[model samples]
Target: MAPLSIQAPDDGTVLGQLPTDDAASIDAKVKAAARAMAGWVDAGPMRRAEVLLQIAADTKAALPELAEKLSKEQGKTRKEALMELDRYIGPFIQYAGLATAVGGRHHQLGGGVAGHVERGPVGVTAAIVPWNFPASLFGSKLAPALAAGCGFLIKPAETTPLITLRLAEIAQVHLPEGLLDVVIGGPDVGELLVEHPGVARVAFTGSTAVGRRIAARAGQGLKRVSLELGGCDPFVLLAGADTGAAARALMGTRFYNAGQVCVAPKRLIVQDAVADEMIDLLTTRINRVVPGPSLAPESTMGPLHTERGRAVLEEQIADAVDAGAELVGGGRPDGERTGRGWFVRPALLLDPPQGARVRTEETFGPVLSVVRVRDEDEAIAVANETPYGLGASVWSADRQRAWDVARRIPAGYTWINALGRVYDELPFGGVRASGMGREHGVEALESYLEDRTFIYPAASH
Candidate 1:
């Protein structure tokens, strides 16, 4: 069979071909992963940690090459790709240090009995990572899986599999056979991996709709599943907030990865008292963002990853505009950006209809919708209106007020006066339809581990 072709969003050029996998390939990988688990467990936590650290070292050594690959395949600038690739190593190191910390609990039972609870890996795991931020998301899964002694098959998104293929080559050289395997295909291959009888766990980072299907499939098999899914996050600008800083922060999140981030702020909720100022500041900053090819150093934003993505974004923009949303800066592409690349200008929408698709849906494009509210309570109401509770950001001069408002918002993670960011030390995930389970920190370790208890006589203990 002919392999699938990967087209670069920046230039519409063919990057490479990713060979398709079938049910048999997935079955073989699952069996191999199951076979590899015993050896990984025998190596113990410390040895696994050592190998994880070595992987981190290898990743860092190949940063430039990997970053270039990431840019070409994922349509991100080299600078941004470099930062993301560097972040990929952090989880490995963090999980390595945390391996020894994941200890079991001992409990005293009455009547001369004692109990011990242990945490251990689920064998033959599978990770389905999205195209956006592939390296970072994969690291979030791979690092903790290694520390917990789980063997997993990584299925990178069809649009961006080159970097992961290269990473797999490095893994084969440094880690045990079958410990890390990369299978390339679309959703069918992912479904095969999820429903495989031999696979015990599934970790996915993608759209909520797709995640629901994976979760249901995994649930049918009674398999452990972790989903880090979609978000239509809110950016709240309270009264007395610094308009300039808030605009900068908002644009920063919206323009990063060309606003393709699942946790990027989609709704801009501002106090009616300062709505005009916020709009003015946002339009000025957004206009300055140059939308060009991802490889260009001067371009602040890049094209959408696929033509379909651009089409969906354009449809949303048109709906919002027809519904009386004022296009303050950008909404359509023009001039040089109107060429072959799938580029959309950074758009600032003022007073868009609450029910507008751009306001309600996760546009996944460089579009920011502003909603003016009466007070803090209204701002909080608007923030939590979305079914997605992935992330939110609050900007206020009073730190205490920001914290208080952030606390009221129903989200898995919230930021005060800053945009969304993920770190290895902090737990990241969402509530509501955003996702189930968590990633990063000890929470991620828990997702891949299962608990077992042993009871014995006190004397035996």
Candidate 2:
């Protein structure tokens, strides 16, 4: 068979291909997973942590090959690509460390109810991971589900399915084959896993449109679903804030992953007092960060994940420019950019008309849109305008005031002193169109588990 190439609408090639496993095979995998999980669930905290330790060690040993292949295949810069490895490794270690300490709590009994409730694993979980942050997102889903005594079937994104599949291969030794399995393909395979009755729970990360579809399918099966969908997060700067700090924070949020991140700061709102300085500094930063082939040492930024990603972002930028959004850095297509892989210059555009498509749309690219506001009130209103509430960043010299304003925003996670960044130990999720449910942190394990009521009323009662 020929090598798979992931092209968007233009090149017309499929990236990853998953084998068709019949119902019998699916059943076999599920059965194997259940059996393995039974033993794993009973392995006790120390033994389970030991198993995770081996996996982490194995991951480190495999890092060079794993990171390089994942980075090259998906067009992420080596640094950004390697970060996934760290993300995966850290969570496994953290979860393993906390496993012995995790459990349900006792509640005060009232009325006729005598005993508090307990939570238990719901059985096999089917996890579907997206292309962006492939390994990290996969780890985010799989680690918790597994830690909670659940088995899983992985459906990795087409652009970067290899690493996920590879993770499963290693699991075959330590994970007992179906205890953790990977079906290496995209949406077609996803439909099978989602609609399959045997798969009890589903975790997905991707666009909101697809999330809705997954929700619909999962709903039919009454399968538990956890979604981390698209986010057009806003980063606000107040009049009293340091313009320099805001610019740096925006640089980190807006350009990380070449701006393909779901919670990446898509909007930059600055109070008018320092808006001009803020925009100028932002332009300087966007211009300085170079984008190119994945392997380039000097390349801090990398190509878009796929041709389609690059094309969509380009169109959005074009629309914004035509719609009168001032382009501070991008809009010129360089030969170097067009000649090699899917690459676009980082864009810094000022806010255009109200409800402009660029302003409203999630441009998951190396682009940042700037909006000017008269005061903190307008800043909050503008920030909260988006239907997404995945996360937001607030910057001000008055830390207390920034925290107050941040609380008013609709996003689930808000950073007063930093950009829209995440640590694996914290709860992460969105409020509205950004999707429902949380991933990572202690709550992540809880999301995969179901609470049950146990009654032991007194005989007299």
Candidate 3:
């Protein structure tokens, strides 16, 4: 098979190449994991915790080198890349602390019977991570699986496999041989992992469409699966809210990572009373974004991870404009920098028609689609109109009012006067078409485990 080329989206530089994994290679890894499962589980949680902590320490020591590689391969500014590495480092420590806490309950029943409900690892687990935040998302799955005493296999995104492969390499030093493995390739490799009988559970983070396909295949085999899929999160502003503050928050949340974030505020629903002020503030801020190479010091935002992503974003903007939305602030940045990369100036579309694709679809780039509604009722209604139910935010000076509005929205996660601050302690996931299952917090750790009830008769006393 031909090797896959990893290129820098900022300058089309060939960063490196990796040989794609075939079914045989993936199967060998899965068999190895299955073979090593018992020893890893028998090592107990404390030993696993020690291994995780060591890996985290090693990862921290190599942060600069890893961040640079991430910036080049994933197309985010160096600062953003470092921040992503920080996000990665956190989950290992979080799960490591939670390791020994995984336990069961004992129950005494009548007739001299005693029952024990125990939780145990769910055998070999496969994690299929996306390109947008590879290292962070990988850690979210990897740390939890190991802490739960499960053998792990990973299929990193083809475009951004270097950092994940390197992290796995770093981890393997502290991990039992064949206990952790990475298979590098496109969707075919992922399909092989999902369908392999040796894989007991599959955790995926990607589009809802692909997630559904994975869910179906896993279901046929009666295997456990968790999916963190697409999202078109809403950010709503109420009448008395501070438009300036809201706009400032939106600039970071909406354009971070060039807006490839799955839970970023893709739609802005503002009450008519403050819609104009909010639009004006957001437009002013969007125009100031400096689009250039990821490693360049002056560049505030990097290119989209792929040319296809940039083109799709452009089409979404065009569709919104054709539907009569006002293109308030951004478009293709005009400069010498524009010709060499997949850069797109962050965009703001004001009052896009209700039926515009930007309103209905997940625009996975730096484009914000705004909608104006007459009242909070209309705002909540508009916020819940999308097929996605990943996340939404309500902004208001009145805490009670913001809390009420947040509850009225159907998303799995909602914020009050906040945009994109995801806490490690909170469980995060989506409802409806945004996909099912949760990541982060204890819920993630539990997903890699299974429960068994052991009931035995007590000896006569």
Question: Runs in model 3 with CA error above 4 Å?
Answer: none
- Tens-place lDDT digits, model 3, residues 1-461: 89999988987899998899998998899999888878988899999999899999999999989989999999999999999999898989999999999999988887899888999999899999999999999998999999998899999999999999999999999888999999989988899889999899999999999999999989888998888888888898889887777887888788999999999999999888888888888878887889998988999999999999888888889999999998876667778876788988888888898889988799999899999999889988888778899988889999999998889898878888875778777899999998888999999999999999988986632
Candidate 1 off by > 4 Å: 331-338
User: Clash pairs of candidate 3?
Assistant: none
TM-score of each model, in listed order? 0.96, 0.91, 0.98
Against the true structure, whose lDDT is highest?
A: 3
The better candidate by lDDT, 2 or 3, is 3
Candidate achieving higher lDDT, 1 or 2: 1
Which 10-residue window of candidate 1 scores lowest in summed lDDT? 329-338
Taken over the whole model, the C-alpha lDDT of each candidate is 0.86, 0.78, 0.90
> Candidate 1 on 35-138: residue-level lDDT in tens?
88888888888888888889899889998889888988898888889888878889989999988777789988889999999988977789999998989888
Return the number of clashes found in candidate 2: 0
